[model samples]
Target: MLRTMPLTKNLTLEQINHLIDTGHAFISPFGLNRTAYIVINHKPFMVVVTDVSINAIQLSGSWYNWDELEKMGGVFESEFEALKAVAGGA
Candidate 1:
């Protein structure tokens, strides 16, 4: 959608790399579903499949602001789904 300077610190570079290196080990519960961190066009996003909401899977991502990382983030559904759109044919 729109990219802006992030005003939140939901995730860090180390954490992001960790997520990439380790698949859902931190957030994985019961091994039913896992969370992932993906970067698109210089932005980072967290993807997870949850039944708590009607939409099921949700995404929280954005252009992180190193100075003040507590804002400017948005929600995304799935990385695969998002990438599909980015690939120019969703």
Candidate 2:
């Protein structure tokens, strides 16, 4: 079970915090699943889970650019499962 979520300008910070606090995780094109927090400009950000929450935040370029992160987007289908397997082995 994988799901793709886009962080749009409509989603607010509070709504995103609530979703992670509740248990549903989001998958980015970069393939970071179960990502509770995201670091943008050295600042930590929470993830959004609801449709309404998805419409509350103003997105900035620093958050959207994953190219700076090493090996950020190579993973594709089953990435989450592979990550989980690695975590479990560790």
Candidate 3:
């Protein structure tokens, strides 16, 4: 499946991180599925459903898998919680 339409517009790394940190970023519904914008080492990345049935997520434009994402810094319920997790070294 060719996806011409971008899931999100071109946002700078700082903008993306700001959105995530400020709790503006969210898991947006996409064609009955969902997508999330994540930041790793100040780099913006997207995680989207590859298989709804299995509740799988694939890093957009990259081969990095879910495990890698978890290792980098898994998704949290809220940005605040994520910040706490990092602070506490969780």
Q: Best-fitting candidate, measured by lDDT? A: 3
TM-score per candidate: 0.23, 0.24, 0.35
Q: Cα lDDT for residue 18, model 2? A: 81
Candidate 1 wrongly placed segments (more than 4 Å): 1-32, 36-44, 55-81
Off by over 4 Å in 2: 1-5, 27-90
The CA lDDT at 30 in model 2 is: 32
Give the per-residue lDDT of model 2 (tens digit) for 1-90.
Answer: 867566677878887888778866454343333233333343334443212122131122223323432123211234354344334431
Which wins on TM-score, candidate 1 or candidate 3?
3
Candidate 1 lDDT at 8 equals: 36
TM-score ranking from best candidate downward: 3, 2, 1
Query: Local error of candidate 1 at 86, Å?
Result: 1.5
lDDT of 3 by residue, 1-90 (tens): 954333366878888899779966656333333554455763434455443212334444444455665677765434554565566554
Between prediction 1 and prediction 3, the one with superior lDDT is 3
Ranking by lDDT: 3, 1, 2
Q: Could you give me the TM-score of model 1 versus the true structure? A: 0.23
Pairs with backbone N, CA or C atoms under 3 Å apart (clashes), candidate 3: none
